[model samples]
Target: MRNASIHPRTLGYLGRALSLEYSAVQQYMTQAALAEAWGLRDAADRFRHETVEEMQHAERLIKRMLGLGVAPNASQLRPAGLAYGLVELLLQDAALEAEIVALYDEATNFCRRIADTENAEFFNALLQDELQHAAEIETWLESLGVARRTTEDERAYF
Candidate 1:
């Protein structure tokens, strides 16, 4: 934490983002384990990789909070829901990424309002990363030929 002043609203948003990132890490890790148990080795690996990325995002938020003299709060995490199958898991992941993208967008705007150019840029980059994650999940789902209509079809289970 530095001696410089940080906007309270900016700090609050960062803390929320940190907690969300922690939740994402937990969700991805749990999904990875579930995929492995279901014999989806490739999906498991991808989930595990995403788990690492979420952890890294959390670390970045923590470091930023510390640099601003604000304590990082990872305690208010959102509960992660379990998916019954691979398509469901992918849908959940895409939804999670979309939520994260929205959060980062708000955070970036908040940082801009506070004249915190550095943090604004950081959040922007994070937003880009999350968008990419969501896009990849969408592509994967499409590759499986799982359209919206087939999302809940028990026969679509792989």
Candidate 2:
């Protein structure tokens, strides 16, 4: 039986969030392996760390869904992004982080508009985490002398 506590729109948000988090996990894990293949140990290590971070996010989302009396379902998972160079990989990751942050921001606003304080707080916390991740990607890009990328149509809207 479906729980009546969560708004349907919020449920959609939660599902999409889970999908995006898994997408991040897949992307990062693949990048880590690629980095290792290319003998970029440092890059590989960083990607591995990112993979763990994203997995934790996915787990948290799953637990929240379970607590809400819903069977968690991530309807779609995007393919892992592949790149021949470390810079290219980081650029893709930066774009992905931006997309995730945007989704969480929208979700938070929607929950707030519906006066769902608990869900609003949930989305807001995730938003903050993603924002920090994005900022870190930006800083890494800056340190590498590669300016942040401007991508059109990069967002995989769920």
Candidate 3:
């Protein structure tokens, strides 16, 4: 293992990513419960599975930080308060995934610009998963028609 000191900015980025992963785990678990309450069995199962995946991502980042002699930090994680409706919950999750995609893409691009191929690859893999999650959520939302109805209702009410 190269004892090369990871750049401070890179470490900061990784720390934030770790925090995000932790937050994702929490959010997915919560979503799973909400889905179950709403009688969305398949969606509940999917969220539960996603929670596990998020934990795995957190573990991977923790290992990488340990290897680089840095302590993983979770202080930057944002809290997701209670979601009211099913549509609200799903849209919140989708938005979170979108944010994650943006963050991962930025981190990977930074790594590539600095010639850090390994880190770049890691971020790219995570980004790909985030994008897939976003797309899946979008598809689910379309099928639910909640977003369309919300928009139409808002326009009519306003």
Candidate 4:
């Protein structure tokens, strides 16, 4: 049997990352339902698709944690403060994506510093996905003439 050991800190980070991923899935699902209720079928479809992607990400992370012999924990997720409206939903998603991007960036850096090449590569790919998600949402918001931008002083996470 091959023996692989993961740092305790890395395991803790993975646990936190898993929670974030779970939260994202829930948020996307809520957003999708809200869009459908508001009679925006296209928007709802997009949100649903995004939710599926988030779920997949969570599963991947879970598998990685297990492979590393780390116990996976699902903690309560942070709430996303969002008002009830289409514009609000889009803006919230964009902001959330940005936060996720920042998180993955940090994780990647940490992995590299610890010489965890595999995790660093994985996080780098996740960061790219997050950036794309943010860009897509921003484009949609801009098309709707909703100018949304996050300031540096704003909180890093939702």
What stretches of model 4 exceed 4 Å from their correct place? 1-4, 80-82, 153-158
lDDT of each: 0.81, 0.88, 0.80, 0.80
Q: Tens-digit lDDT track for model 3 on 72-149?
A: 777877676577776787788876776777788889989999998998998899888887887777778888885533
Instruction: Give model 3's TM-score versus the native structure.
Output: 0.86
TM-score of each: 0.87, 0.92, 0.86, 0.88
Say which prediction, candidate 2 or candidate 4, comes out ahead on lDDT: 2
* Candidate 1 residue-wise lDDT at 77: 78
Using lDDT as the measure, the top candidate is 2
- Candidate 1 per-residue C-alpha lDDT over 63-131 given as tens digits, one digit per residue, 9 for 90 to 100: 877777777777787777887899998887777777777788888888888798988998999988887
Candidates' RMSD to native: 6.0, 3.3, 5.9, 3.2
Candidate 4 lDDT (Cα, 0 to 1): 0.80
**10 residues in a row with least lDDT, candidate 4:** 149-158
lDDT of 4 by residue, 5-78 (tens): 56666666778778888888989999888889989999999999999998988998888877876667869696
Prediction 2 TM-score vs. true:
0.92
